[model samples]
Target chain A: MSVSVSANEVADAPQEARERTILGLTADAWLRILMPLAIGVIALGGWEWAVRANGVPSYILPGPIEVGQTLVRDWHTLSISLWITLQITFAALFVAALLGLALAVLFAQSRVIELSLFPYAVILQVTPVVAIAPLIIIWVDDIRIALLICAWIVAFFPILSNTTLGLNSADHNLQDLFRLYRASRWQVLMRLRLPTAMPYFLGGLRISGGLALIGAIVAEFVAGTGGRASGLAYRILESGYNLQIPRMFAALVLISLTGIAIFLAMTLVSHLALRHWHESAMKERR
Target chain B: MLAGVKAGPPVVTLDGVVKRYANGTLAVQGVDMAIGQGDFVSLLGPSGCGKSTVLRMVAGLIAPTAGRIGMAAGGEATGDVGFVFQEPTLMPWSNTLKNVMLPLRLAGMNRGEAADRAAAALAEVGLKGFEKAYPRALSGGMKMRVSIARALVTKPRLLLMDEPFAALDEITRHRLNNDLLTLWQAERFTAIFVTHSVFESVYLSRRIVVMAARPGRVVEDIEVNAAYPRGEVFRTSAEYAAHCREVSDALHRAMGE
Candidate 1:
């Protein structure tokens, strides 16, 4: 009757996982790292070859080498802007995690509360962040605060949705055992539900990491922040307007690096949390 | 409460304990039973019968819809009541020793004392070297052993199990039946086991209480004259076979066979 043990963790897992991965193998230990790196390398290589062969203008599609030069030349400016973007992303992420977890716990505990507000949450998730960013910007006045609200809106749902399901979807037999032993509700959550939810929570965080980055950048673009406190997005737009193609490519590199850093950091955390107990993070081949 | 005490003052009693669901499903009706001190009893029935329901009620996990159930008042429930579920049901996130220590933690025993108690229990269950291994890392039989260790860790006066070894292979089940008998002999604790297998009932229990489905109630109460620490040779004996067959046939009759 229950679909899969993994359903509570990865709701959007591919319906049919592909077997092919450049060879006849189901998995590779470093595939998560290797696969992404490989894709990035191949993409950059193609971009370089396309530019050279067609003799296109550098302003349109700056090659990786030119982008690297621009990055080195404007290191201080890029670093400051990147730091601002990073600050907003992490702040939003922390708030979203706290709020999402609290909401999940609330919903998990009471059916009435869950039933009353779950539809509103669904509506919030479905509504676009871009549509709400302008409103949040107008109300907040502070550019940083506006960007945080936008990013939180984009990132909060996955945590809440995944965590609520994880809390509810604990092994029923294990739950019965805990009840039989008269374990308190707090004990049940601390010992059972939280551990079970870690994988799901991490999976949610992985998706939300990308969303949060996109949200921060888009929020910057929409709000148009001041000179001294501008983010990577502002620099990106500034470069584009001035036709600084290599510098634009440099900004693009920073954004991609941020996304990759967020992804890798989350993956590392996921491995650390579940490495000992779960099959998902198993290292030794059986 | 008076009804529970009315059963001639048993160590534990279930008097007219009816369990009817809101869906109008009467799983158990007026089930009266008493377990004396230090007795090994098995509630045997088919899949749908209320053997497990009775076990759960005894373990205080589920309350009956009607009538009274009582244990010796304030008699150390946290420390003196150990329950083994159908499957291992070990906290998969915890190691073997930690799983065993859970009851001790609930009992408010200190960590060092709990660890010592858990160690002793694991040794009793023949899992001395596996204290650090997680449940998922263990085989089916080993996990069940850990479950048994966890149940026995508190040195509870009463232990309740609901088809604990039902998921195990035949050899594992037989081996564990022997191991369980040895543990019971060593511990001298009261145990109430729920099982659908008549063979397991005959093999393990000093008394077998057979029940029927659709208003679950006892249809037969028979005693096995087996001694403590029973072994594999007991299974091959004519007397054991006769008892097993009788219990099997009684089970068949209880199911309206």
Candidate 2:
């Protein structure tokens, strides 16, 4: 009887396993998507109900439907502003990545240089971008360049510090092995130190993405530059002076959405890069 | 007296080697030994005995404060030495094949040749189909096997292992020990193994150098007259037991010193 039961189990195992996985995945995946979506719907419904029930004016508190209508009505202007903001954000992030990586490598190569210069990086990070934007605009002459500088400053330090730590954190035993093989400095940096620093660099990049967006928005706010080439932040400022509350809220929604989109893109890039090797990106498997 | 069945000319010679750290700690003192070509020697001692320091000095990872360590012509050049740490010490970012191919790539070997050699080395260590597996995906023993494969990928003349299997479970440790010995026999590389386990020292080495701590120095060197390809039967043999007893006694004596 035991032998026959065992045989039956072996025969039924594959189909049973396949059925279980399909059902399991569907349940799990649905919960993950539905939970957040349900919360969002409830919150929006409450907001819409409260606005109507209280008879709040559109200027003071637009309902969710009014906000959505404003977003669609102002799509052309808002999108152009969004494009400008996105351009600055991504440009700042790109420059920050390049400069941060270069500076970190420089720091890795020499202790004396790091000791002399690293305090300045800290100073730049701690000093608020808003505090410096006006002076930067005055000194740089170009408003766009000034805004770019501000965003770059905000996004630079994380990458530099994280990559430096990662480069220095290469396994000591591996360093010894490299030395035993008499590897050159170039080989050590490229083959060992750089690979070790990759996850750390990606981590910093994710943080800097959001920061770059905030920096751009803040710098533009301080710049107060109006018309033609104005970012979403300018749209908010312009709408405030004109009492366009619904348009202002619409701009806020776009900014928040952009920030979320940038974060998701960074996460996807990190997952793709490290899915094969890193603990952070790996999925559980038998 | 140091005695061993010398296999060939001495591949590595250490004469009165001393290592004093920058903080003025006398890590090792007056250590003298010669490892013959294709010989397996274990530096057995408790912690703080500087056995690892001595191994590092031999591998040229660190210079001795007051002694001379000479390697034979074929053993002194770049890529002629391989060192394994107590931990697997693999690059977490790379797959097994890439990790094993590192030395060859560092030495400027072409991609195709390096890949073939790395794959062969992986196969030699029983990791043939795991070339693409990352270190995080592997079990401890499998990771250690990849490390061993990486070490031997260059076919180094001298292999320095500092307690390579000390962190493993007893069963895994024993299996790795057997596999390591098989590799040594097939590769014909001189090995300097560091360990604190008496049974491990007795089972793996042709000669065991028992060391003492606090101004770390060798107290006794005993030779094992057992034959090659020692397996489970040899491990359970009376001869192996006797050798283990002798080494354990020497270790105790060294500790007491």
Q: What is the lDDT of residue A145 in candidate 2?
A: 85
Q: Which residue pairs collide, candidate 1?
A: none
* Per-residue lDDT of candidate 1, residues A60-141 (tens digit): 8877878898999998999999999999998888888888888988998899999999888889889988788889999997
> What's the lDDT of the predicted structure labeled candidate 2?
0.88
Report model 2's TM-score to 2 decimal places.
0.93
Instruction: Tell me the spans in candidate 1 whose CA falls farther than 4 Å from its real position.
Output: A1-43, A284-286, B1-9, B73-76
- What fraction of the native interface does candidate 2 get right in terms of contacts? 0.36
Q: Report the C-alpha lDDT of model 2 over A83-106, residue by residue, as the tens digit.
A: 999999999999999999999999
Binned by DockQ into CAPRI classes (incorrect, acceptable, medium, high), candidate 1 is: incorrect
DockQ of 2: 0.28
Clashes of 2: 0
Report the Cα RMSD per candidate: 7.3, 5.5
